[model samples]
Target: MNEEINKIRELLDKIEKKNDVSEDSLHGTFDYFELPQIIASVIDFLQPLLSPYESVIYWFLFRHSIIETADRYIRVSNSQIAQGIGSKFKSGDKVKVASDKAISDNLRCLMEKKVIVIVGDTNRDGTLYKINLPEEIELCIERMKKSRVENTCHVEQKKDLDYYNIAENRLLIFERDGYVCYKCRKQLTRFSATLDHIQPVSQGGDNSYSNLITCCLHCNSSRGAKPIMEQFTSDSKVF
Candidate 1:
């Protein structure tokens, strides 16, 4: 009687495996050793290979166990990927849809890297992607972060040259004009300050420090296409 009961139990187990379709069941059967920490590590490593949008899409798949987030009937396209990447829609027919291509390409790349696997077809409708964490992913993530930091540092250094030059010019202009708009005595913010040509650049004025004066935006805009002297005189105003 015990042997018959054991055989029945084995038959039930086979039925259970055959009928299971839930994500948990699939995971338990195929990747029984997977833990939340390992999944997180995989995402962290994958982040660098992806743009912000791609990273979002990749993680969404891992956490929810669903691919092709949009309606499958909508026909996955590149524009959808661009939408995910924050691009404005040109039209449904414009080029190819970005969302479909981006997801497909990234999935292929991830598979090639062995960070994930195609376990099976989804309900006979879509691909069942199983997530995995591998050592190369972690290493690749580290290298990408380092590259980003270096690139950021280089941009900052380039910007500093113009910033310092602007600062030095401000000091000289303040000394020359007593730190006020020549006409209004208004204090200037950086945007409010402008370098007006003493003589018009079109009328043979050279682009040199000595040939310019720091003027306010109000004065500059009011000056228009006319020379400064002509502008103030034409309007009969102090601007």
Candidate 2:
């Protein structure tokens, strides 16, 4: 009887292991978002401002540090960046790959534009760079705000706050709300996210950051001009 009981236990363990494996195979291989999706917002915002070579180099470093290595910083040589991005040079007779000087110049240009920052001094291995997506976006927003404020009086600035549409402002709202829809409590990507006015503009809402909230398109549209506090109170959902 003892021997029979031990055999049954071993058979049960095998069945459980097989079920776990089957479940993992069915569901564990898929993910809704990856590195590319996470970085898509930065790309969309900066694409128009970057040159062809600058964009290529940026993507190469982004893939290496963020996608391939899952790191926020990367050490890379100018030659490596040039080769990875297919920068070319004109030699005496044929078109050769970019020289280190050309690559260095472009890297410096990126640094000047605040797109990349040098994190470490040049060493025998390579120079380290930290990508500056969020910082760059913030800087862009600040510059625009400053320009607007300087060109107009405070009253005009407050009345015409169209800068709310800027990428940086949107990102700030999303970050403040933990990237979840205020109404539905669903996670949102930069692409799928929209901003809603807690106080409807039709009522008295201005474009001040405090009056804006991150929301999904469905919630933003469905809310229409309804007061947020009333809706939340009726639904018994705490904002």
Off by over 4 Å in 1: 1-44, 51-54, 66-99, 122-124, 134-239
Candidate 1 positional error at 158, Å: 42
lDDT per residue as tens, model 2, 2-62 = 9999999799767744543322121333233444445655565555567787778888888
Which 10 consecutive positions of candidate 1 have the poorest summed lDDT? Answer: 66-75
lDDT of candidate 1 over 1-239, digit per residue (tens): 99999999799757644543434333223322334433544554466666665566555555444223211111223334345444445686674335566667876776676555665433323555554432224444355355445554454444224321455444344334433565565655232456666667788765444455667767766675556575455655533
Looking at model 2, the pairs that clash are none
All models: lDDT?
0.49, 0.66
Candidate 1: C-alpha lDDT: 0.49
Candidate 2 global Cα RMSD:
13.3
